[model samples]
Each structure stands twice: as structure tokens, then as C-alpha cells.
Target: MNYIYQDILIENGDVVLDAGRNPVLIQDSAVIAQDIKHAIIESGLSVALIGEKSRDGRADLKKQIELLVEEETRLVPGTVTLEEPTLGNIWIFAKTREFGDLQFEVKEVTN
Candidate 1:
């Protein structure tokens, strides 16, 4: 089974998940990272990989994600922010987490 973070469209400066009935705000680009972070530790899912690829804080986020993945541990609650969205695929479930350079199926913008 596959779980999709539906109603999320990352435009220039807009990234938010409709989440259907509940409007989930993505705020900025970091929002994606925040969501991944929440989905991991809070989801009760194990981590496998996490890291960033930039000269900014992004690199730090990447490293952190990777650490959690390798350690198979969850980042303490409220350790990550649900702000902007990150660009990449962060794999996490009820028991594992992995980072990949692959792209997942995101619904096309309809409006």
C-alpha cells in the first residue's frame, strides 16, 4: 500500500496541503521538510535516511534526516518545524525512513 500526501502543490512561493477537509498550510519551502519530520517521529515510523544538499540550513536538515534513518530512531517530539517545504522525496513509514533521489506521483495542478 502507498500513502500519498495529497492536495499539496509546491509553486513558486506557495506550498500547502489541502488535506481535504482540514486545510494544512505549507507556508514556505521548508514546509515540506516540516511535514516529513512530523510524519516520521510522530507517525511512529522508523527512520532510515535524512540529509540536505545546499550551502544553507538545508544541508543540515538533510544530515539530520539521514542520522535518524541510520539510527532507526525518531527525532524527539517538536524537534522539527512544520514550516516551508523541501524539494525531494523523504520516505518514512510506521517502521522505517529512507531518502531517495526519485520523484513520486504528485497530482497536477487543476486550478
Candidate 2:
């Protein structure tokens, strides 16, 4: 199967197909953890594909959702703010140490 990293759409464990018929997987926990780390280092954001119901007659498809991002929060300096209605997501923030290491803090935000 081929992987499309930029914009992925998944509903639970299902893969959403693209125009070119490329297969996309939801990826397990281990892969997801690594993906989040890479995304934070590379783009400052981690994106995931979540399966959502299609209003139309098409099959259920996944939509790209931000799993983590620096600006998702109201974005106070040294802080991240997320505006979620149900607030079921967990976010983690990390600061880069002088030695090029990272120190992390986990926050749970709920509406």
C-alpha cells in the first residue's frame, strides 16, 4: 500500500482513498507516536486522518485533523491554546533545552 502523508483522511481504522486510488492507513499507536514527533520537529504540527460520516451518499471518509500544533491554542508565548467544543483531545507541549534536548508538558483541554 502507498502512504500519503500530507493530507490523510481516515475514519477509525478505515483508509480513505484518493483520486489516484492511493490507500491511506490510520496507522497504529507506535507509528502515530513517531509521526507526531516528526511532525512537531518538521512542521510544528501533527495531523491525523479521522473517519467521519459523509453527508452525501458516498462511503464514510476520513478528514484531516490536527493532533498537535503550537498555534492551536490561543498561542500565548510559551503556551498553546486549543479551542475545542467537546475537548476530548490531549495535547503536549515541549521546550527545546540549550543542549538541544526537549522537555515536555502534557495538558488536557476540555470545553
Measured against the true structure, the TM-scores of the candidates, in listed sequence, are 0.24, 0.23
Model 1 spans > 4 angstroms off: 1-54, 73-88, 91-111
Per-residue accuracy of model 2 over 31-89 as CA lDDT, tens digit each: 33334434443442222111223333111111112334443322223533323222223
Candidate 1 per-residue lDDT, tens place, 16-39, comes to 456565446433323344444444
Q: What lDDT score belongs to each candidate, Candidate 1 first?
A: 0.37, 0.33
Which pairs in model 2 have colliding backbones?
10-50, 10-51, 10-62, 11-51, 73-81, 73-82, 74-81
Error of 1 at 100 (Å): 16
Q: Which stretches of candidate 2 lie over 4 Å from their true place?
A: 1-9, 24-79, 87-111
Clashes of each: 22, 7
For candidate 1, the per-residue lDDT at 36 reads: 46
Root-mean-square deviation per candidate: 12.4, 15.3
- lDDT for model 2 comes to 0.33
